[model samples]
Target: MTAPGGNMPRREALPAEPNPHAQQLAEQLRALKDHGELSMRQLAARTGYSQKSWERYLGGSSLPPRAAVAALARIRGADPVRLLALHEVAAGTWNNSRTSTPAPAPSPSPAEAPESAASPESAASPESAASPESAESDVLVASGTSAAGAGIGPAAGRSLRIALGAGAVALVLAVSSTVLLALRLDAHEDGPAVASPVPAAVTTSAPAPVYTCRIQRVDGLWYAGISRTPDAEVAYGSTGPGVAEAQCLLRRAGISPGGIDGMFGPLTQRAVKALQKRSGLVPDGMVGPLTWKALRG
Candidate 1:
């Protein structure tokens, strides 16, 4: 809901029933402080107004000059329209105070001005027409603050109300932009992660079995060589399933089993022992029950 002084039309009832303008002015002050990231003291310092004065203005205990309103807008980097509207309110209140009398009959609505009147100044510096004092007054009239006061007359109040309504809409948009930006950042930071699918298990159980014939006698025992040819060896260096399984297990564990040249060679023997140790089995190179269970698993 709009405050009495603000442009917004949905006027909210405040506990400060005697002066609806006071509540809206308070909101304007809060919006400035929030948007500008300024403390009351800091705003006072920037505008050359004392902190006490700022407090009183913001606290709704007293009204300030149109110049002060413009100074506040400049300090906050806010649009001058708001400040100007506030200035008008202050001026209206001041003018009314001189008479110390009730408000006169309402006046007719003012004619619409060029769009340029609504646009921000093009120059880097504020124009003389848009000076702090002028702009502050403009803000007051624009926000319906002056309308609420006695001096501006009844017709001016309606125009000021409309203008303040428009200004309030602009303010809402400005504030929402910041809120939207924050929401976007929060979404990016806490967004969910897409997970990869786990691989399917191979259906085939029995591995293509390796053939095992006793090798030619080497010095005395079967020493993992050809049976009759003596020169010929197995398909690979492997002696039997036991050694091959050990090699396969080692490969699965990210260790090299020397190209699966599966002779029960030194490399194979070491790999078997390593697997045995990893599986909490006795560290013998032999594929006994414990070692076999580990390799199979």
Candidate 2:
């Protein structure tokens, strides 16, 4: 269901005509990608721009960055001057649209607001101070007094205190007896000894996946079979085959991605950043389309 002139399927309709400049810019970019015979996903891979971003830019949902416009132009083998110029005009229009709308008037500050001549309830009397009456905050004192609003008097308070103290003693004795009984039972148990908890933590983790780089050409792109995804976005703390694939390719590129462990740890991220720097890409420590291309090579 792709558009006739573009590979993007049934392209989204542009926003209203208020941003004609932006809309025109998006149309032109869409044409460029179409002429290049590349889908938005492929464009992302070749241009280092995200597919969703291209969708927004081409759909006129928002203005694309200057770099994004230039990148698409490079991918399409077109000069970026015209697109950049159009982008400048669209950027101006976008900014104007945002600023032209009237904002709600701000409320006056307390100092600037009209003041009443007198406020009857502004000053509270000392008698208005109320004690908390919630049962959670209430504590019955042994000194012949209960919390305010709690109906218990001196004699009742003493009786309650005695009952609570007795309950506490009973609980302590129950816990002690249980512990003693357990110790005695454990001492008498006759069978194979229970396993120690010391090795539990060590055994909890499964082994990490291993990868071997079998670099080979596949349709003008190199793949190592770890993952064929050339545009899967990965960053620090990412995991799975994508991370492992990045590691395998990184190893082939002579940059260690730390044991090809599936986990994308700090060491793997540092290695990715290093690889990105060497490849003349932004050293973002993230694996994007461009970084994947570099690794595939």
Candidate 3:
């Protein structure tokens, strides 16, 4: 039966037994979506997959590709390996089912039957004709052998002389070619050598130096420094070298803090909030010890 909205019924309610592995994977994906508080549309926006595709996946109507599974797991911070294993099992089961399906038996072509049945009939004619032809061939061969034994005929002697003359001509042509090749080689050796043009070397730009983030206590306060230490709170509207360090760290964590001008702004706040959410902390748009630890970690 069709669903109330006229959509196809969900696979879960189907009569045929559902694939256990596919059902399990769909359950895990549903739980992950709940944990991330993400709707199908939101997931599509984040993962570039269509919302309807995700619906089919969650509804257990179809198996998702491995890449889709990986992308979902990455967004939800779930274990991709486990999900992929389930996908593999489901994919294998699908493949086996398709392979096990019985195919229609092949029918013999009309031309094949006629050709097979006519083979013996055709072969008998050739066999009957072969006997007389072979006898004639044998008589001819006996006559030729007797003629050859009774001293070479005039035609045979003429053929031998022609063969000898052709051999001599061939030998002469070969010797002439060899002499010409040697002469050419000697002339090439005597000539002055010509140098080939060399290609210019290609130069490439060097890679930028890597910035290592560190936390250190300086004087009487903490400062977040690049390749140094961290001992400061970088909140909205904060400005200093510490703020710059925080921005750098956020950028390193794949978050974009608007600028690295040592000024904390809304962009930086949003990045911090994202990090906080991922780190399972309260996202108050504040960069405290926990936020710093999450960033550094």
Candidate 4:
């Protein structure tokens, strides 16, 4: 059921991207934030942090404190392990941003370079240079010698090794990040967690607001026009607009999401699995980018 004239107030965009490393951490936090459907005020009230601080953390402007992350995990019923891992990795960038790097040793001046290089050659007597066949070069020259005996200089060799090492580390991080994200999503897709407890600060007397799934087209994608977050991970414990959006997409695909009450329960999980199985996805009950793309498509 498409709502042709569906409208939702546009939300303010987040600040410009933060450091590359920090951005990944921020994105995960944003997805969790969507899961709870909490406002900045609500998050601040719960975590005892200022709303501005949350804006910085969620916008990737700064690294969040460990305690703050833990508090949010508790509130959202997240496992906290993955979030903490991401935070630990992102902290490298945070710490580096504050620390100053030392400059490299200066290269010898051009005038001094020639003299310094020539002194070694000048030191060798002509008698040693006139070595006939007594030098060890006879074997090397016959079997493996080339005129290219001069290898990279010490400075150049060190730089090359450092660059290669950095590239390898970066590749490892990229792979690890992908696997961890998949594992986290897969881990969350189960029977809903037994919520431990809601802190008094963030607790409210009012009932959770129900969202209507106003399905519509935008940029050639189907959106609920409620949260308008296409990539947020929606799992068993998730709620709010993300849930409503999934429900609408499930229904659009001709599977009932048990009527879209904005809570993620057994029926919605089944609907998600049905869609994944039909679409040839892995059929993990959680809805991440791939599942969301299938839904929108």
Candidate 3 lDDT over residue span 1-297, tens digit each:
334432333333422434777778887887787677676657765665555557777777756666568778989877789888888798767545534553332234798658644766435554323332233333434544554667866455334433443344346446856997999998888665432222222234454344345545565434456523344666888876667788777887788987776777889889889989989999998777777777667
Candidate 3's C-alpha runs over 4 A off are: 1-16, 99-297
Quick one: ranking by lDDT, best first?
A: 2, 4, 3, 1
For model 1, how does the per-residue alpha-carbon lDDT over 120-216 read when each residue is reduced to its tens digit? Answer: 4323325434433344445545555545655766555655554554455456446856897999988777664322122223444466545333333
Per-candidate TM equals 0.28, 0.34, 0.30, 0.31
- Model 4, residue 15: what's the lDDT? 51
Model 3 weakest 10-residue run by lDDT:
194-203
Choose 1 or 3, whichever is better by TM-score: 3
lDDT of candidate 4? Answer: 0.67
lDDT of 1 at 135: 49
Estimate, for each residue in 100-175, the C-alpha lDDT of model 2 and write its tens digit: 6533322335763333113232123221122111111122233224422376544445445434443543464468
**Candidate 4 global Cα RMSD:** 33.1
In the predicted model 4, the residue pairs found to clash are none
Worst 10 residues of 2 by lDDT: 128-137
- Screening candidate 3 with a backbone cut-off below 3 angstroms (N, C-alpha, C), the clashing residue pairs are 215-229, 215-230, 216-229, 216-230, 222-231, 223-231
Q: How displaced is residue 84 in candidate 4, in Å?
A: 64
